[model samples]
Target: MSNQEKFVVSRIIPAPSHIECVSGGMFKLADGCPITVISPLAEAELSATLHDTCNVYWKATPSFSFQAGGEGIAADGYRLRVTAEHCEITASGLSGIRNAFKTMRQLAESERGVLKSTCWLLPPVAVEDEPALAFRGIHLCWFPETPTWEIEKNIRLAAYYKFNYAVIESWGMIRLESHPEYCWDEFAVDKKEVSRLVKLAASLGLTLIPQLNLFGHATSSRCGSGKQMLLDRHPEYASLFEPDGWTWCIANPCARQYLTELVTELHDLFDKPPFFHIGCDEAYNAGSCSLCRENYPAKLKAHLMYFYSLFAKRGARVMMWHDMLLNRDDPRWEGYTAYGHSSRGLDELYKELPKDIIICDWQYGYPEKDGKEPDWRTSHFFKQTGFDVLVCPWLERRGIKSLGCLAKQEKLFGILETTWHWYRGSFRKETLFVIASNAAWHPDWTPESNVVYREYLNRHLREMDQDMKSKKYIQFGSVQYQINPAPYQD
Candidate 1:
């Protein structure tokens, strides 16, 4: 295989189209990373990511002569060339320039901070590049230790790989000042931190989509010290499932009013993102209360359709979990209780829900094993039914890749790798984010897993190791946010 084909970074994961080494030359960040640009926006970006590493000089026009990319470069596409005299990165748009720097950062870190002229390193080469999909992203649900710095790094990491979308499941993060009664004061993410992270992610060219648990998963907060964000203060709204668990009573006429207030409050906090995630997944054991009984499953369907219109009126596209509507009984999930409710009528759901709403089909599992393949019909089915679909996954890289293939056949909007896995680096092949980024760009490009795994870890470990040099914490960058040190655990 050629050098580009042999390397995973070069071949896929936001891969460029063409690559040709100029031979015997390179660009070094250690030598002031100057960028000549006609746009003030590019200059501002230089001041953000590169200002700390080198004396970055940004100007309106070329400071040195070099060949630039010809016209007809795709959006978020870049052309790069380097030689012994000077190195040049050029593109017709800002996204292209942003991608070029990402390539540069990857090159610098891939070789353990060395200036070797490797393709992974900014080799003396002329290349053209663009993303495989329009909406490549990561979906983060808050874990106990989800600090501000960690979230920022993840956003920066996504940008480094040229991802354009991020879905933050900010459960009770934003200040609920508009309705403090529902806020979890102890662990609610600071409102300022959310604002800061949003701004930072924006600088990196990522559009942040805010997620709020509207119908299901409201109990997620009350499970621990995250105190009564909703149900306790407003038991009247709870779905009162069988003996105990709670989801919002969808049939209750008042529920929409309550949710509208919550949605409006979240919109105000996020400055109104174009898309909103109204988590309607696995609303297990719902419609039990007298209020939902008379309405039957129709109410279950109406809850989302009603709100989809409401959110649309406010100029936002609605996104929701697709499990409840798409759930099916599979042997892999037979014995254990599945989170997705099988009792719901999938046919009726297909007929009722709004066609414009984006469906997050989170079909997570080892989809292929011993020649048996996963039932990817849900992803394919959602698209055929006239709705945009996002395939979400965790664990199972090849299986996720398969999901992407199925997505390719349908209305594939994007891929969202859910959550931050906390496994020790030594045991895993690569972090899920890296694996996900690879799948996001080219899921059908199958290779030996071990080779791709090793390549991912080698580069990732080197980047994190470099971060340890200046900071006490084990992070990829100097901790950008302030907080008390986390308790050390063995």
Candidate 2:
């Protein structure tokens, strides 16, 4: 058999759009090989990516040569050619070059029968690739219990997997300068840390969009816990939220001003990205306050539009969860997860909301009554009503596949994979990241077997450890311990 027939097979994740194996000897990637880039814009990125590659495969960093122009390559696409003696990359932009290097890193494998070796081998092939969707992203949450290192790992992993955007929603973890009491004193992430993460994501060709719960989740804590981040300690500020402190009190002028300052602080902290996620989901107590009840849905409408206009002036477009815009009682979405109750009258706001406001429709499962795959009716509803929509899925495989397929087939905005509390533990985070990355990159690619999936995930985890310079054995695997530890010490 030819060298191409013996070595070449589909190994890269979100598999490349096009790949052709050439009949030649394997490319020996020895230490200190030369990496040439034809675009100056991609030089810095190539250096950063190659640093990781060198650490993974060689004892010394490869030499770099930069040139001027790449005419035919797309801004977000790349063409790569690998031969026995050379590996050439052609791209017009930083993102394309970054992607090309990522593909190369994934394809590299250690030389056989060599332990602790620095050399690696690559099959002779030519590849042309680019993401299918314009807004491919993953939504990650930083709760009070989450460690900063874990957040950094997730951000780096998302970028390494070629995701163009990441929505970081901090749950009582971001320290607000204006309102010091907004976050937990013990676990709050300060502005410096936030800025560092933003810069890190930017360096890796990933845009980090800030997410704040403007409507519901006023306490910046989960509903099940019933622990309020603000009111729990500063009961004096109770008027700013509903009686239960679950939703922000939109009727109160002071509450509106407080939220405005918080948004401004976070926006500036994140370097003011083009998109901001103003979470408006599961607002069960939206119109409960006496003043808010007097105005009903109109007050809510005005409150949301206020931020919409605020973001517009700041050169940003607003994104909100789609639950509040959908009526739970509507027969059209009988079996879907729609949280807009008729009493709150939030579904009516869909017509009034600005069409430019991107709707993030999150559905974690198929309809209870519907057949196997989810219909993704809510996303279609938003699109049919003249709003650009993103289909979000949590940890469900079928839901991820169905929503991703819908996004591709309907030409919707994109897919946003949410990793709320799952990022903490339980191996769910890794599973979600792998599946979501694959689905978003190529909705038509066949799902890999469990064995192959686990292998890719393990390699990803190991690469992350190398990138972070992790030393402890506990930090090596998906979980810290092989088995759950005892509950408490004596």
Candidate 3:
């Protein structure tokens, strides 16, 4: 065995200095501190080894050293060597350590490595890094009853790709009746489990943002005997109903109280950041209720003002969808807080909301945009708008390929990829949720570039042939094109 092979390598370390008898080196572990030391070459190889874990590590040779950093194939470990002046972690070295480092810097400014095993080298001095956008992130897991492997995988890839924020839309965490764990009509949320998910996301250098629905899409509230359904109890607060059976409501005292309680609980759960997305879109029947019809404009204005006061008191920056205020013909979307669309209302929305409030324009999978189309058409317009925008996409097969192409575009702020199990089935089937997630994180990463993601998905499908499948599977017998829209979707 070589001299470098004699010692049991607990983990790689950065370059070390030997003044007296004691040697100082860096190692891999969470928190702050070093524990052991291996060979000088082992320290250099730490960046290469970092691929096996999501945590950060330090690399050290003799003359040069660097924190394991970079993204894409380059960051995976094309070049890893330690030096006196710099710890070189190349683009192709150690599973994109460059990308990882850039992402880490966005989440937390820390000098510490994974563990305190030994004195480790710092990242290479010559390395250069930057993000594709400002709002890169992964969709927070909504179904608490379901396994979080998909979302966990999402954070892992988000870190790999360089996304900085994570937005969660969990029904289970909100103590709602629709969640599977409800017992005897009681509502509850698993706070510890939710915390575990948040910590994991944070460790990956992804900011955690909770998404709370304030209006419309309250199916969760109607689950238990329709008792908690604001629409059922306070019919006056319910949104208008369309002839086509679409339901809507307003911010009456009853609805406001319910929403307040929910927001307060959520605030207690996640107290890190002051920014919250008060979902107020998709109000199908905003003018149907008698009260809403009598005072439509006033109610709308008061709704926003009321929440602005409450959210401001909590020290939170606010974000919301601009759909309710968008005037298709008019240039203005009407003054509103942060607004979002399905990659459709960029031009008008940017003109309406405060510049500081972010815009989340989603494009699920629509690859092309002709004239007057909602998705691609709108995205083309947003390219020229001076506001920050986030592109949201889905995790299905079609969504994966389409979004990979979108992520390659440089003008957009960042992508918000989602692993949705809504309107169809459980999310357990999308086994490669993490792979698609990389599209948002890595500008260079594409659906075609994700061999790991493809292989995992193939395994989950049991290697079927041309037909839909032997039995029922994710891809089915054949492949079909999925649609992409706006900067938001499941």
TM-scores, all models, native as reference: 0.79, 0.93, 0.55
Candidate with maximal lDDT: 2
**Candidate 1 stretches greater than 4 Å from native:** 1-17, 30-71, 109-121, 221-243, 327-347, 369-375, 409-411, 420-431, 444-470, 474-490
The pairs that clash in candidate 1 are: none
At residue 226, give the lDDT of candidate 2.
Answer: 84
The C-alpha lDDT values of all candidates are 0.61, 0.81, 0.44
Q: Which ten residues in a row have the lowest lDDT in candidate 3?
A: 10-19
Predicted candidate 3 versus true structure: per-residue lDDT over 179-264, tens digit per residue: 22321212334567667767766655566787776655454332333433333333443333322222334435765675676666
lDDT of 1: 0.61
lDDT of 1 by residue, 1-490 (tens): 4544345244334445555655575554443434443222445444444444322212112233223333566667777665545556677666776677666555442334556532223455666666556677778655435655566666766666667788887655556655665554666766676777788778778888888776666665534464445565666544433224446767666666756786787776676888898887656566666666564567766777787887888899998887666445755443222355446544357667778889887866755546877667667677888989888876766666766666655549988777633422432324355567666765555554335544554454445445423254555432332453555432
Q: What ordering of candidates by TM-score runs from best to worst?
A: 2, 1, 3
Candidate 3 overall lDDT versus native: 0.44
